[model samples]
Target: MDKHTIMQYFEWYLPADSQHWKRLAEDAEHLSQIGIGMVWMPPAFKATGLNDVGYGIYDLYDLGEFDQKGTIPTKYGTKDDYLEAIQALKQHGIRPIADIVLNHKAGGDELETFQVRKMNPTNRQEALSEPYEIQGWTGFTFPGRQKQYSDFNWHWYHFDGLDYDALHEETGIYQIVGDNKGWADQNQVDTENGNYDYLMFDDIDFKHPDVVAHLKEWAQWFLETTGVTGFRLDAVKHISEDFMADFIAYAKTLQPELYAFGEFWKDDIDTTLRYLDGTNYQYDLVDVGLHMNLYQASQNGADYDLTTIFDGSLVQIKPQSSVTFVENHDTQAGQALQSKVEDWFKPIAYGLILLRQEGLPCVFYGDYYGIEGDFAQPSFQEDLDKLLYLRQHYVYGQQTDYFDHPNCIAWTQSGDEEHPQSLAVVLSNSEAGWKRLDMGTLNAGKTFVDYLGRCADKIVIEEDGWASFPVQGGSISAWIEESI
Candidate 1:
C-alpha cells in the first residue's frame, strides 16, 4: 500500500453559502490524484444556523435533515449533499472523516430553572457563589424535528454545567448542583485552570448512562447514514478520557477499521503523552507541541535552533500515534488559537512534516485553497504540490538524519526494492549552505537536480554515491534523480 496523507478539508472562515459539500464532491478526484488517502470533513450536522461552523452543535441526529436552527441546511449543505460528498470521496478512493464535537451542545430550544453554583472561570475547582435556582438554556426539545430520529429530550440533568443563567440574565460558569454532579475527575482531563472540562455551552456529563447509550446509538446510526470511515474527535481534552476511549472502541465495533484521532490541543508534550496513555492509545492525537515549535521557529527565524525542533514533540515521543500538522482551522489567523505560521517558513514547515518518515502528516485546507474572511491569504498550492508529489513518489525506505547544525540540516532516504527512488532534502533557516550526504553506493554517477526549482544546480554523484546538496537561505530543496 502507498503512503497516506490526511487533508483537513475545511477552514474556519468558509463562506456560509451552503456549497461546501458540493465543492468537495467536485474536487474529490483532484484530491485523490494528489495522494490524499483521507479527508477530515467539517461537522455536517445542524448547528446554531447556516452561519455556525458546526461547532456550536444543536442536534446530532439532524444532519441538515430537519427544519431546525432556523435553517434546513448547515453551514455546509443538506444531508443528501453531505452523503453525496461522502460517496464521491469514497468513489475516488478517499476515506471521509467526520469531525465529531461531543464536548458540548449549543443553541438550545428552551430555558429551564435549575439550581447551580457559580464557579471561578480560571479555577473551576473553586465555587464563587452558593447554590441558587437560576433559569438556564439547558432545555433542548428539538421542536422543529419533533424527535424524528430519537425521542431524547435533553434537560438540565443531562448536563453538568452551563455558562449563562437566563433567569438572572447573568453570564458565568455555573456548575449544576445535584446528586453526583460536577466536573470529571482531575486525572481524567487536563490540569489547566484547575479543571478544563467545562469549555462552552451545556457540557455533556459522560457519566450519565443515558448520554453514553444515546451517543453510542447515534454513532451506529451516523456510520450507517454517512458511511464515514473515520472520526476527527474535537475538544477531546475537555472530555472524559475513559469515555473517549470507550467511544472510539464502540465506534470501531460498528466499523472495525474506523480511523480515530483527537484534538488534545496542548502545547506541552507531557500532557499530550499523558492523554494518549490515559485513553489507552485507542486513538491518535494531533501533535500540537510540534506545531508550537514550528510557530516559535517561524517567529524567531534564524535565531531559533533547528536541532531542537522535535525535542518535545509528540512525533518524537510517540510517532506511531501522532498526527503532525503545519496549520489548521484553529491555528489560522483571527481564530481563537491565532498562531498562524509565518508565510516565509510555511514551505520549510510543510517540507519537514510531509517529507519526513515520522508521524502521519496532515495538510491544512486554508493553505491549499486560501482562507476567507478578515485575514484572507492566497493559496500555497504550487509549492505544496511539489512537496506532495515528492512525498507520494520518493519518501520511502530507510531514513537518515543530519541535525548537527544550528540552521542547516539534511536527510536522505535509501529507496526500497519496489520503489527504486532516492531523495536528499536540505533546509536552512539562516544562510545558504550545502551538505555532503551519503545516499548509498548503489548509483555512483547518477545526476541529481533540485525538484523544487529553488536552486538551479545539477551535480553528479561521486564514486561513493555521495553528493553535496545545496539549499538557499530560508528555503528547502528536495533533490531527486534527474532521470526518474
Candidate 2:
C-alpha cells in the first residue's frame, strides 16, 4: 500500500529561534516510526525579519545564511541545520517538502518613488486615489546575501502593484500603471474582488519575463541546494495559473517525479476545478471544500447535513487531486482564516480524511504536538496516533461508505491480500446508538477489537458478514480484527 502521509511540521506561533531544525532532525526517527511519508517543513528562507513567518518572503535564495533581515538564521534555524534536518528525514525514509512563496515579496532593503492609483477596498477594480508619487518598498538589493545564488534584483517593474504608500502614510490596493504596467490582467486569479490580483505589497508580476526566469532559476537552485523531494506552492491562487504551471514544469525538469502541490485555497469546487483545469492539473490542491464542509458540520452538529460531508467537495469530484487536512497553522488561532473545527468533531473529521480510501491526508503539526495560542486552547492530539496507525495498515483495500445516517455515519474497509487489517470506522455527531456495519466474511469467526483501546467491548460478526457495535455520542471509533 503506497499511501503517503505528509506532516505539516510547523505552526505559525512556533518558537522564533534556531532550534526548530535541530529538533526536527532529532525527531526524524520517531516521525518515520509513526509512518510519516513526508514532512512539509515551514519556509526555510529568510523572511521580512528574523521573527517573521516565511510567507512574508524577503530573500528566496537565503535559507537562513546571510546576516540580512536583522538575523542570520530563519525563524526555524540556520542553513546547515536545515540541511541536516532534511538529511535526517531522508535517512529515516521521510521526504522533505519546501514551501514556496512567489506571489509577493516584502521588507525591501530600499524604497523607490512611484506613481500609483489606489483601488477601493470593497471593489478592487475601481481606483479611488489618483496617480500620486509615493515611496514604495519595492527595491530589493539583497546586500547581506550579496546575490550569492542568483544576483537578479527586484524593483517596481518586476511587480504589478502594492498595498502601502509609505510617503502618504496611507494603505490601499494600488495597481502600478505606465505604458504597459497596471496589474496582472483579469485572467490570472479568482474573481473575488473583481480581480484578486494585488494581494499584498510588491506583488511579483508573473507576467514579467525577467521575474518568471528568475523564479524558475531560483526554484531549480533551491531544489538542488536543499535536496527536497517536492514543493508546497503557497498562495498559488494569487499568482497566474499559467505561471505556476510553467514554473512547476521547469522544476520537474530537474526532478521529474517532484511531488508538487498548490494552495489554491478556494471553497467552491467549480472554482477549484477551474483552477486545476486552468493549470492543466499540474499539481494537486488542498481540499478546502472538504475542510469547509467538515467545519460547517462540526459547528452545526445534528442540524447540519452530516450525510453530505463530502458533498460538492473536490474529494468527491476528483479524489486523486485532493489533499485532505484538518486544521493547519492558519486555521489554528489568531490567524486570518480562523474558522476552526470544534474539538468534539475533530475525530470525525480526521476519520473522514484518514480512514477513507480517497484523497491524500496531511496531518497538522499543531494538532500533533498540541498547539496553544492566546486565542485558542491546545489542539486535539489525543487518540490521533492510533488513527495514524490504522491509516498506515488497515486503511488499505476496498472502502464502504455509510453516509446515510444524519446524526451518525460509518464506513468499513475490507482488508486485501497486502494487508489483512480489515476495520470499521463509525462516527456520531449526536446521541450514540448501535451502528451495524459489513466487515465482510473474511474475519467472520474472529472477533474485532477496538484498535484505539478506547472501547472495552469487542464486536462479534454474525454469519451474514455484519457486526453491530456501540458508538459513543459525539465520538468516533475504529474497530479492527482481534489479532490486529
User: Please, what is the TM-score per model?
Assistant: 0.99, 0.97
Off by over 4 Å in 1: none
TM-score of model 1 relative to the true fold?
0.99
Model 1's alpha-carbon lDDT is 0.92
The number of clashing residue pairs in model 1 is 0
| lDDT tens per residue, model 2, 1-484 | 2578889999888878789999999999998988789999998988988788789999899998999988999999999999999999999999899888888999988888888788886777888878878788999999998879878999988887888888878877888876567655677787788888778868888877888888878887888888998899898888888888988888888988799888888999988998899998889999999888988988998898678888878889999999999888778768898868888888789888888889989998887887655754565556677888888888888888888778888888887888877889888889876688887776677788777665789788888788896778888888987865
Evaluated with lDDT, which candidate comes out highest? 1
Model 2 misplacement above 4 A: none
TM-score of 2: 0.97
lDDT of 2: 0.85
Write the residue-wise lDDT of candidate 1 on 242-333 in tens digits: 99999999999999999999999999888888889889999999999899999999999999999999989999999999999999999999
